[model samples]
Target: MPFTASANDFRVAPATVTEWKAVYGEVETVNIVPARARISGTVVDVRVTEGQEVRKGAVVASIEDEKLALQLRAAGARVAALNSQMTNAQTELTRAQDLLRTGATAQARVDAAKVQLDVLTSQLTAAVADKAVIEQSAREGDVLSPADGRVLTVPVTAGSVIMAGEPVARVASGRYYLRLSLPERHAAEISEGATVVIGGRSNAEQPRQGRIAKVYPEIQNGRVIADVEVSDIGNYFINERTLVSIPVGRRTILAVPPQAIRTVHGIDYVTLKSLQGTLEVAVVTGERVEIDGKEMIEVLTGLSAQDEVVTR
Candidate 1:
């Protein structure tokens, strides 16, 4: 006679199973901007440092302006001198006209004074315009941030001379994303907007869901690169690495609670409970996964949807 035992039986049923492709990736900023020098001069001031957050149009560095300041002063002086000369020329013209009306000066002398005043006036106008051009050049000496972001590097210091267009600091933009390189063989499986699971193994917090944001058409080093966007990514550091899962497609299969299947002598088995009795049956298993927050084992073979498996 067989021994009797009380057990709970689970009815096997076909459930939707998603086929996921697991890959490794890194947390990265959406954009990196190189804050560079707009003018060639010695760095007079360093206003920002690494890891500092800055807003758009914020001053990051200042180039030496003593030379520019002197040039501006000289230009102003030249304009002032020209204005004084114009004043003297106008006075001479007025005096010449007064004398000609009184018949004390020749008409030709008044005409000469008028020409001299007109030349002086033209010279003053040109001098003022030249000064404005120098003033604009002085304004461009201040280096500014292109966007709001965190500074990654400040390569120059006070008194360091740098050339125009040289990078003064490197910045990582505010938006964050995950960058993954998938195997080339899985190229056909991935698509934009595919569901993704992020940081399941390393992150202590509950794993977050993300979606495939982009897929590059170009393949390199036998892999295809892609980007994923996730929510609540503020806590993650830039360039930090994490595990990611992307589901390519789905299929219907027999799934059961993990407790229902047990391994004996290196072989997987499930006990089938029927009206007659309990019977031990050999089975093959695949990946263990969670469905709707419940852990389930994939029954690849040796199990059917019509069977009732006993689980203690």
Candidate 2:
């Protein structure tokens, strides 16, 4: 039996196309600073929790300072003792001067008293400085935030033992950007200042345009890494995964309606309609692209503009 074909046909025309490669990556901040404990002690208090926002120089946690308190007391005592000794030396110098004026104390005794007063004055100055240093160390027991951002992780809880210079909390500095990993083959195509489209998946709420900020020199696992800067980031959380697309190059290709393409067995074909007769033509397909909300199948080969294909 002879099967009738649809009279309507689609004319193929070369369309200017830009090829985009979809890459998977995560949302991250450009600056991430770890807040560390300045002194070794048991965690006494935590002012901020995970996901809490903090300002620069804000106190994040406090360490136990019982030992520091004792040291501070000892320092204060030393300073007080120096002050007492200075006062006594000044009194002795005054007595010696009065005796010298009366011809009761020798000139050598007055000179010795003046020297003692001067020495005690210097000792007092040194003691006061030492006390100030101890106070400063005690103040550092309170951990502070390094930057303005949300706390990502707090590894230690209250009552946890911690060491000096160990990171207690990890923070995301709120300068959000995207980190993408692509194949090493794309190294030549991507560079700093290139355009990147983010949130390109079907479920994405809004597509965003980003600029490539950096391209890492080292390639690991056959993949190249790049960082992108984006503007709209209030809706995205740190470390959230998203889809990114980068354009490699532009070319001209034939695009046909979806119904014009047919699958027989494992091969794709299109029905060509011409004055000669109807013929089934084999085609190699590329991406299914959407233009202005209209979907079209890209013809990689076996078709060109000026060819007419049956729609049904």
Candidate 3:
């Protein structure tokens, strides 16, 4: 044993590792739907603004139609009038029945009175139904959210006249994802369930993991689109642009532990072992990485699979 410098020699060999490509992913919603007005009227008030989270059936805006109010008033008056007429007819029918029993009126007179009362009763029922129909129409003036989501667009404002079925707000519902577009050249490398890196190589923090949830079959504009499902992607801002690293391909290269390579004056050198002689050789190094829980660095040049490296 000469000194502590003498250590176990590792044979440097070519190994395949995933090649990553950096791309910007846009945060988007899976479903974009509109909350529409249920009835044609002037928007009286809007309860929500853009980016507000709302639940399904929550009233986003209230609409009012003067015509509907007038109709409701008319219906109320008609119901009132029908009730008065029916009450008078009931009194007349009771009096006529009394007269017929006392032999003071003909049976036909009492029969006619009873028919009049029945007719008034039916008219009163019809009037009440019409009043309820008008009241329902008034309630429909409250524009409701179509689904539980964040409101994206609210084009109409208070006092704006809009028609029935017109959009009051555009909502983004369902789960959010990072929509990535990559060049068509890397299409074959991407597949569902493939691991993805949340941040690119520039980020020093530990990369968050994501999965390829879906890959679109159609290639448009020479680009391949994919939906990545990151567990905490929902925390990202909608439509926010962020960088992600995807496994575009794989490459075979020689790698060795960093302990084997010693740097002097910015030049990297490693101890080489051979049958003829052992010497320190200058080696070109690539990016530093960890493989199998061991610190390793890539040897871009001055290295071969036949070379055995000793810890410096």
Q: What is each predicted model's overall lDDT from 0 to 1? A: 0.85, 0.85, 0.86
Model 1 worst lDDT window (10 residues): 1-10
Clashes of 2: 0
Ranking by TM-score: 3, 1, 2
How far residue 165's Cα lies from its native spot in candidate 3, in Å, is 1.4
Best lDDT goes to which candidate?
3
Q: What would the TM-score be for candidate 2 when compared with the true structure?
A: 0.77
Note the clash tally of each candidate: 0, 0, 0
What lDDT tens digits, residue by residue, belong to model 1 across residues 140-203?
Answer: 8889898999998899999998888999888888688999998888889899998898865455
Candidate 3: tens digits of C-alpha lDDT, residues 1-312:
111223578776667778989899999988999988888999999999988999999999999999999999999999999889988898898999899889999999988998998898899899899899989999999988889999999999998999999999999999888999999999998999999988733456567889999999999899999999988764566898888889888888788887888899999999888877788899999997656666678889988886777875
Root-mean-square deviation of every model = 4.9, 6.2, 3.6
The positional error of residue 151 in candidate 3, measured at the CA in angstroms, is 1.3
- Per-residue lDDT for 21-89 in model 2, tens only? 988778888788999999888898998888899999999999876788898899899889988888899
User: What's the true lDDT of residue 185 in model 1?
Assistant: 86
Candidate 3's TM-score: 0.90
lDDT of candidate 1?
A: 0.85
Candidate 3: residue 134 lDDT (0-100): 89
